[model samples]
Target chain A: MAPKLGIVAGSGGLPAKLAEKCRETGRPYFVLAIEGEADPATVAGAPHAWVRLGAAGTGIKLLKEQGVVELIMAGALKRPSLASLRPDWRAAKLYAKVGLRALGDDGLLSAVIKELESEGFTLVGVDSVLTDAVATEGCYGRHRPDAQAEVDIAHGFRVVDALGVLDIGQSAVVQQGVVLGVEAIEGTDALMRRCGTLRREGPGGVLVKAKKPQQERRADLPTIGPQTVDLAHQAGLRGIAIEAGGSLVIDRDEVAARADRLGLFVIGCRKPS
Target chain B: MAPKLGIVAGSGGLPAKLAEKCRETGRPYFVLAIEGEADPATVAGAPHAWVRLGAAGTGIKLLKEQGVVELIMAGALKRPSLASLRPDWRAAKLYAKVGLRALGDDGLLSAVIKELESEGFTLVGVDSVLTDAVATEGCYGRHRPDAQAEVDIAHGFRVVDALGVLDIGQSAVVQQGVVLGVEAIEGTDALMRRCGTLRREGPGGVLVKAKKPQQERRADLPTIGPQTVDLAHQAGLRGIAIEAGGSLVIDRDEVAARADRLGLFVIGCRKPS
Candidate 1:
């Protein structure tokens, strides 16, 4: 029999979807739902352990007890400060050893992944489980990016690349040959809402997301879904462009159908270099 | 005597200050007050004519009639869409000739400058008109950036430098090793307001403004003033940094006093090579 798989759940439906997949495949899986982050409903019928984000060694102990030899971290967690984190003793010890001067989000995540790996649990990537979650190149649905949108999408990619080098956020919105906004700590939702007010009078903006150059590839990739399409539509955007092979699309069919219904284009473009 | 000075006044106190300076220096000057932009009080008691932003040939005619030879564009003008701009025949002609693909703010400004230059007018930078307006190195008031703030400030500069090559906006805020936000077409005030909601738990972010690499030097410069300080304070920012010699600091004394009262720092630093 395969080793028991552990899902470290945070916010959003990705974790729930992963759990449902395991149930359908008849694989034994356990969830470690993070308090104040993961939805309780996601863990309602699954064998799970509840813990705060700051539970370091204790969290590992719970997984070990459940015979979880393989782990998959899914969903989103906001970057919290050390004070807000309220890390336990083991967590505090790990942070001390990170020795990061410019403490980036990716750096903290890398440290966490290292600690998990040292405990003898193999980190299974999302692609290894949910095969279709990975984005691929080409137009997604009924609509397509016009010539104007292509220009804006190109600009957005350039902005993301420059920002990625500095460990900044991964998304940017460009419209009618002008940058509307770039995502930072505020995340993609806020970026869209803010850009809504800043939209120009021509064709609408395109939202582009890429993997931050400094991101831990095994831990996370940029993600988009039905909510992303909804946000883009509400923000008066004409389309969405995510980096193919470097981003995850939750429920591709649902995302495409939503984009079609809302009169928007959703495409996965190859990152320029 | 200096050439007959023509002040193309937009929004804010900078235009009024410039007009007052001309009065104090006894330089013959005419103010081209932009309707719906320049405060009426600013052009009061000054030789002036009102014009819409789209007034091109007629505006130049008015300036020439006033015997004005040197033009100083002052204050802020929000970027306008061509549809809303209602461009006159001459203005439309210039826009058509520019042929910009990814039409950045700087590219449009450069085109405008060339049009005026070809019309036999000399465009002077803000530094030349208001000698004290240009930013200088060092802290302006009571606060110096702490070690953390300094790191953020450095990060902010890097963000601006990266954004500059693409002709994006010149200001960004960083705190606790994270980029809070970047200025785009929405301008600095909106950037501050949005970032206020995104501020982290530790020390406040620092606002950094630099000249976009492709900006038109003889026409405009990145600017800050007492109002900039107020915005930063309201946004929970701790300090302000501007590129020395490349950014304008309106009413420097008043700005320092306001920053000090608000418990914020305002400094100017050299742009990193």
Candidate 2:
């Protein structure tokens, strides 16, 4: 018998894409959507149940009922306010065990993974199901980065590495050896918009997205899609670069097509030696 | 006879305040205002001349004619667009000597200082004329930062230090061991407004401003004033902490009074050992 997969869906198009992949592969799966985070329309017509963000116990119970022993988390969940949380007994216990108050998003996710594993649910990475989406090293579009952009890419990598260590962010906008902006709580889209406003008349910067050096790679890998290419072009940036084999290049062909049309370079850079 | 002083005025109330101090002391001085940067009203009734940002030759010639030997630069000047600049022979020579294209604001300022000194102008620090505006080490408001705010302050200092090394901006907002924002070219006021939008229900972060580790201190020292306190309070921050001796606390009494009334702490922190 084939293994039954479970997707703990959050916001954005990733969850929908994952569900479509499951359908195409003739695989059995279930979707557990978090209220206010996962779009109901995206998971419609699928085996799904809605649970609050803090209802870890409730989510597990629903998954078990549907015979879900293997799971993957998908999409982004903006960190919710403390007052909005309604943690159940299981979540409360886990929080106490992990000392959740002191941990950042990565720490909290790590603790949650450990807790779920202890409950006998095996966690699988999203890439296992969406293998084709993974980015490969080298340029994907018609345009290639010039020498200046290459230098910027190297500088951006170092910056993102340092930021990862502090668990601050995974993206940086750099132009001509100067860092234009570093993303914190604001998402990539907002960061790109701000960079657009700050662009000078000359050649623009590159948007480099990489996994945090210490990031738990099973989930939360850096991702870019066609929209990302559009945003970069709109921001007057010359190119978009992501970590090779460490980021998802969603809609790869479309992303390449868009980049070519926009005269932007989309390259997957190798991690610095 | 006291050496006649020259004020290289930029935009902001600081130039006006410096003029007031010169008047109070009955000192002989001249203000060489940048055409688009400094307001004419600020230096009214004083010996002043308007010159474009690129007119370094004209400025130096005027200062020499007025018998000005000592000079201090005041206020902020947003970097001008290339199209707006009309670099004369002197400015062009200075730029070529300094390789100004590769430098950030501080590096350019340092090169300018060296060039001015080489031309026989003694560059004095703004603090020499506005000693009262320099922040002293200690708390100045009724409210002291709670233990958490103190920790945030220490963390903020480290963040700012790292940022300073990169020639990034000199301010950071941190809360609960997480950095909420880091200021880049957008500057302090804009940074504070963004932080206000990111604040949650819990205790807010503290704003820490410090000089870059390698900053040329004769000009461009970090500064805060009554308006800074207001912005911090509006951002829901617990307090404002600045580098003592390295930062200017303009309108000291007014800042303290505002902080006290707003239940915020205004502290001048000693540099970490």
RMSD of 2: 2.6
Minimum summed lDDT over a 10-residue window in model 1 chain B is located at B76-85
Put down candidate 1 lDDT per residue, A167-229, tens digits, no spaces. Answer: 778899998788888877788888999888888676788999999876777666788999999
lDDT for predicted candidate 2 compared with the true structure: 0.84
lDDT of 1 at B18: 88
Docking tier of model 2: it is acceptable
Q: Which ten residues in a row are the worst by lDDT in model 1 chain A? A: A99-108
Per candidate, the number of residue pairs that clash is: 0, 0
DockQ (C-alpha based) per candidate is 0.64, 0.37
lDDT of 2 by residue, B1-273 (tens): 558989999876688888888888888889999887898898788779999989999999999999999999888765553445668999989878876443567887898999999989999988988988888899987889887788889878887887777676789888666677787667788788888987766788899999998988887788888999899989989999999989898888899899999999999999976
lDDT of model 2, residue B36: 79
In terms of lDDT, the poorest run of 10 residues in model 2 chain B is: B77-86
Chain B of candidate 2 versus the native chain B: what TM-score?
Answer: 0.95
